[model samples]
Target: MKERKGLIIGSVIMIAIFVLMFIKGEPSKSIMVWIAAILTLSIYSFLYKDNVFYKFAEHLFVGVSVGYSVSVVWQNAFIRRVFDPLFITRTYIVNDKFSLYLFLGIVIPTLLGLLMLSIFTKKQAWLIRIPIAFVVGSYAGMGIAPSFQANIFEQTRSTLYVTLSISASIMIVGVISTLVYFFFSKEHKGLLGKTANLGIWFIMIAFGASFGYTVMARISLLIGRMQFLLHDWLGVIK
Candidate 1:
C-alpha cells in the first residue's frame, strides 16, 4: 500500500510537470525537452529513495554510454588504425621496400593484442603475461622520464626560482615548511618544530581552498540543471 501510494504521487508529479512543459516550452523542442526532463527527474528520484525508476535510469545511462563508446572505438580506432593499415591500405603503392616495415608494424602489434585473448583459455593463459609485460614495460619506459621531468624537476625548479615579492616569498616559505614537516629524519624540535607547525596551517588552508572549489563545482552543476529545467523545459527564463 505504501509503495502504491508513492507511485501514485510520483505519477501525479510527473503528469503535472509534463503539462507545464507542454504549455510553456517551444513546440519544436517539446519532445527533446520532455525526454531531458524525464531523465533528470528519474535520476533525482534516487534522492528521495532508491526505487525502480532510479535503477532504470541508471541502467539506461550505462547501456547507452557503453554502446556509444563501442561504436566510437569501432569507427575511430579499430577500422582506422588496425583494419585499414593491416588489410585495406596498400603501402606498396608508395614504396615496395617500405611494405615489409609497414606489414611488420601491424603484425607485431596485432599479435601482441591477440595474445591478450589467451587469458580465456586455461592452457594458453600464461601467454597473456607476454603481452601484459610488453604493454606495462612500454608504458613505463615512455612515461617515466616525462613524469619525472614534469612532477619533480619542474616543481623543484619553480620553487627555487621564486621572486623577491611578498606573495612569492610566502609561497617559498610555505613550500619549504611543508617539506620540512614531512621530513622525519630528525625530531621536529625548536625552530624545526615551529616551521612544521606553520606547515600545518598552510596545509589546512590548501585543504579548505580545495573543498571550496569542489563545492563551487557542484553548485555550478546544480545551476546548469536548474537552467535546463527553467529555460529548456518550462521556458520560464531565456
Candidate 2:
C-alpha cells in the first residue's frame, strides 16, 4: 500500500514538472532539459529506496556510455589509424616510390588484432597470447624508465634541501620519520620508536586532509546540480 502511494505521488510530481517545463522553457531546448531532469531525478530516487525507475535510468546510462565509446573508438582509432593509412596514401617515402613500411605497419597490427579474436574459438584460443604479450611488453618497456626517473629519482632529489627554512625543516623531519616508521628490521623501542610514533601522527593528518578534500568535492557537485535545477529548470534563481 505504501509503495503504491509513493509511485502515484512520484508520477504526479514528474508530470507536473514536465508540464511546467513545456509552458515556461525554450521550445528548442526544453525537450532535452526534460530528459536530463527526469534522468537526474530517477537516479536520485534511489536515496529514498530502490525502485524500477532508478534501475531503468542506470541501465540506460550504461548502454549509452558503451555505445558512445564504441563509436568513438571505431571512428578515431580503427578507421583513421589503420584503414586510411593502408589504402589511401598518395605520398611516397622512398625516392618518390611507395613505402612498404607503411603497409607493413598496418598489416602487422591488423593481423595481431585478428589473432586476438581467436579467443572466441576453443581450438585456437592460445593465439590470443601473442597480441596480449606484445601489447603488455611494449607498454612496459616504454613506460618503465620514464616512470622510475619521474617518481623515484626526481622525488628523492627534490627532498634534499640545501638551505633549511622552517617549512623545509618540517618536510625533512616528516620524510625521515616516515622512513623510520617503515623500518621493521630494527626493534622500535628507543628514540626510533618515538620518531615512528610521530610518523603515525603525520600519516593520520594526511589521511584526514584527503578525506576532507573528497567530501568538499562531492558537496561542490551537489551544489552545481542544485543550481542547475533552480536556475535553469525552474527559473527560481538567477
Candidate 3:
C-alpha cells in the first residue's frame, strides 16, 4: 500500500510539473534552451543511483514523449500519407479510371496485413510463412552472400601489400609481428617476441583512443548541459 501511494504521488508530481511548464508557455525566446539544459542535467543523474525522483522524472519523460509521438505519427504519416491520399484519390483509383496503378499499391499492402492475424494462432502462422521466406531470402542474398569471399578476398588483400614502400612494409611487418605475439607457447626472447610486444602496445594505444572518445562523448553531453543552464536558464550569454 505504501509503495502504491509512493508511486502515485511521484507520478502526480511529475505530471503536474510538466503540465505547469506546458501551461506557462515559453519564458521569452531563450527559455526553451534553458529548460532543455536543466532537464538534461537532471536526467543524467540517473547514471549514479536509482531513486524515487529519477523514476518519476523518467516515467514522465517517456509518457510525454509517447503522447507526442502518437499525435505526430497520426497527424504526419497516417493522415498525410495514407488518409489524405485515400480520400482524394479514392474514386479515381478505385474506379480504375487512373493510370497510376494506385489501387494495387493500396490493395497489396492491405492484403499483406492478413499476416498480422498469424500472431494469434499457430495454424494461421503458416500463411505468413511465404512473406517471411521472401524477406529472409532477399536479406540473405544482399547482406551475407558476399561472406563466402571472406577468407579468399579479404585475407588475400591483407597479404598483398607494398613490400617496397618503407611505411607499408613497416605496417605489414607490425601486423605480422602482432599476429605472432598471440602464439603463447613460445618464449618472449627473439624478433617474434619483440614484434608481439609492439603489437600489444598498438592494441593498448587503440583501446585508449576508443576509451578517450567515449569519455569525450559523455563529457560533451555534460558540457552541453552546463552551457544550457548558464546561457539558456539563467539568460547568461556564453
| Predicted structure with the largest TM-score when compared to the true one | 1
Across residues 119-207, which tens digit of lDDT does each residue of candidate 2 receive? 99999999999999999999999999999999988988889944668888888888889889999999998899999999988788889
Quick one: how many clashes does candidate 3 have?
2
Tens-place lDDT digits, model 3, residues 1-238: 9988997898789657655654554433665665565567467657646766578678878999999999998798666656666776473364456735775665555456556557679767777876677668878998684775785677658667456788778667666766777778878778867888888887777799999999999899778775555445544444
lDDT of 1 at 166: 95
TM-score of model 1 relative to the true fold?
A: 0.83
lDDT of 1 by residue, 1-238 (tens): 9998999898799779767776876533678777878888888889768999889989999999999999998889778878887667854335555667767777788789889989999999999999999999999999999999999999999988877899989999899899989989999999999999999999999999999999999999989987888778777667
Distance from true location, Cα of 46 in model 2, Å: 1.2
Better of 1 and 3 by TM-score: 1
Query: How much does candidate 3 score in TM-score?
Result: 0.55
RMSD (Cα, Å) of candidate 2? 4.3
Ranking, TM-score, top scorer first = 1, 2, 3
Top lDDT model: 1
User: What would the TM-scores of all predictions be?
Assistant: 0.83, 0.81, 0.55
Please state the error at residue 169 of candidate 1 in Å: 1.5
- Supply candidate 2's per-residue lDDT for 142: 99
